[model samples]
Target: MKFYSPLKNTICGVLTAGLLAVPLSFSAVPSPAAEADASSLIGAAIGGIAAHAQLNAVLRKYNDTDEGRQEYFQEMKKQLGVNEDYALNHQLDRIMTNLTAGIGAVDPSIYKKPYHYFINNDKSFNAFCTLGHNLSVNTGLYQTLTNEDEIAVVLAHELGHGQKDHPAKGARRSLNMQILGAATGTQAGAVMAAVINNRNITKPMEREADALAFDYITHTDYNPGATAAVWQRVLDLSKSQPSSFQQFLSDHPADSDRRDTYVRRLTQYSGGHVTNSDGIVKVNTKVFTTPAAVGGMSSKERSYFVMGNLAAAYHNGQNKQEVTVDGNTVRMGNQPIMTCVSGDEPADTLAQRLRQIK
Candidate 1:
């Protein structure tokens, strides 16, 4: 079923009538002052009830069945236009396939209501999974993230929301809170819009999704380190262009916090060899390379990512293999650790250092 906003005039009229009746219902009380207080309480109670009913009605349309979900998906796609690019769609499809397989390996019940997803034409670096496991990716995400693992990290985060039904839970929680506030413009339509657009997800829920994304990535062939790298990349980008990332940062946890969370998690695989001191990546209580800014990455931001790669190498047992140098690139087994840039040490020297340290 489709949901539409109630007309402003109709809502205003009902609210006005309710307010007008408040005093009359309490008029029989002996004290005028007591009547006035009672009226105020009754008016607030009535407003809350009205808003709650309207919001619940909107939430009820979010059905879990396949047919009901397809109906909702069609309605949403009409507003969020579909991307016509076959290549982009194919890329998203391949990523989703890999991610779903990973999720299935972790928990198979999520497949009971198979996901429906598509790439939207919206040119924003954001994606959301709404009710019924219906997901959408903005085309602008590709503009920012070219790496498959980075993109997979994003899609996996949304899948975590779907797995836990965060969208609907967050929506209900938001609507109820707004209803209790019942301030001007705290209408059901406004709350529902924010909920569907994914603005209402709480910080705690964001953290949960981040952790789940890391878990899902570890289950797949994708580098689990990308979870930290993606946030570090965002933190680096925001340093240069703060306004571009303000909206996302405001809604989610601090990028530094997210980067650190994943980085700390990644250290679990290193058997205590890898550690992060402040924002710097360290090895065995010794100072490793202090990465300089490369491209958009700041010195500290890049360090976390380098730490992530080192952690992933350990996790994959690549650390057990020979450390090789191919021109500017340093590799542990098949895993590339770092490519010596203009400001960094020579590749062969770095490889020898890795042999000593790792």
Candidate 2:
């Protein structure tokens, strides 16, 4: 008998190991345990084969174009990193189940497809909806929020994006390369993954989402003001950390104008409502503090301070008033200190205004 080579024997052993590791794939019909066991291994093998076959089909479609080939392969590599695809899918399914129930309470047709969530371990405060019914939220964001209202704001924002079909628009853009036959199998995978992984909230889109979120929460017990508060917190959070804003700013560029937009929308939705007596409003101005600074005073605090100063001015009834600061006397305006900080003015003039106020 001819002597067998060790390399060949090793190859055979490796192949056997792979065969054992294969998982079964099944159709609509359920399988018996014995059949299931065999099917699992065969299924895994078949799945891999099927994946490759699909990849090849995409590659062939894009083979004539270099750009297409590049895009295709990139998309392929992204989908292959499934450590626990099944578990993730199941968890996502459950989240959708709950979301569906929640949304159904408001509008049963709010979402056409079950919304999916992806927990990215990134420190950035970002969340986005993607093609094929996926929504990704950064772990950093989830940790930052104190209540369900904040979470609801973020989720509803993404849902708004989904409802508006932003993801589908992105998908169409990616497939534009396919028209040129420039995408490869690998590039296609990359494009798909990118299409999946990208969680950007554009400014207009962000505004739209904010509006939708306001609508979403107002119908429920959740405070609509939390929507504005979340953005305000994001703004303050960005100033000190800078990094936290990276993802948020990327998706939804935070212009002062955008902040104003949110404030305006919230105000309109609430019919210019100021008080949160219902306990539904969960405003955490502390959440808006910069990391370097101590927790900044809340909007409410600033408002109260102004109101108190005005009241004191009225009580004194002076045209110009002087109040004791750290040591020196600070001057108030003839009109209840029209501005917060006093500008240059003669001590006599300031005193004159204080006397007039009363």
Candidate 3:
């Protein structure tokens, strides 16, 4: 019943080190060949079928029973710790909902599954989603984000993963890579890296998620400028460090290209670089796991090894809990915790203010 949240894996790995240290900027510079296609993905050995099958299995199992569904939510609630501030949680929920209202209206069936949120107190920027529309946002993510538009970009990107089944899709992609490597003589350690290092399937997934995020936020009051601006901030903030090193696949995109994509998406939306955001947004969270249930190594274990090697390579360092919600209260075990709305501010108003730079 457990499922892995690769985006969280992606999120958690926000502060990574790179060997080549090819610094990038979030500006618009295009490339014809960098986009993803399943056929040309890695050598000619792999296809998308195996990956799809892997995902199908997870989807099927999660839907098989009420117990499975309950367990899925329970594990997530227990594992990803959250000290929820009701005022914040309620505000986030309302804003996230209102922002994505168009999507819900267009196809409510797509959202038949329940969605929840978790807020972690991490200072660094990271947000990720699980298989069943569960998402986690760092509390400080709001602090770093300059406006609602940027938050929309982050949340929408994570939503895109759930909508597109990117985590399972990525897992399937890794499974394909694993099979292809075994058939074609890839080295053991190298194969490990390709399969679960977050390297093989991440870049394409990132691009796809970015595209989906843009799609969701379009026509909403959210400004497209903020979309590109936040990523640019990422480039600006991380400039001193080495380029980020994800385990398996990476966009390795120059910041310029990444920013450019968002800009282009915005241009398409408002026919210009700047637009007034009249859109609303709201929230919730969870972490997911699919532990390989094997005789030997788990996917997480594989990453830990690769991450260790990666750290040893850089001689540097790196680094969830659980909670429950009942009606308007957030809790830990039997203890009921009280949360206040901080002057009774509406979610929409607070959300709007939170998005702005201090």
Best by lDDT: 1
TM-score (all chains, Cα) for each model:
0.76, 0.46, 0.52
TM-score of 2: 0.46
Q: By lDDT, is 1 or 3 better? A: 1
User: How would you encode candidate 2's per-residue C-alpha lDDT over 43-88 as one tens digit per residue?
Assistant: 4456445433443443344332445434433332243222234654
Output the lDDT of residue 195, model 1: 46
How far is 191's C-alpha from truth in model 2 (Å)?
6.9
Per-candidate Cα lDDT values, in order, are 0.72, 0.44, 0.45
What is the lDDT for 167 in model 2?
A: 49
- Residue 149 miss distance in model 1 (angstroms): 2.0
Residue 187 in model 2: lDDT: 31
lDDT of 3: 0.45
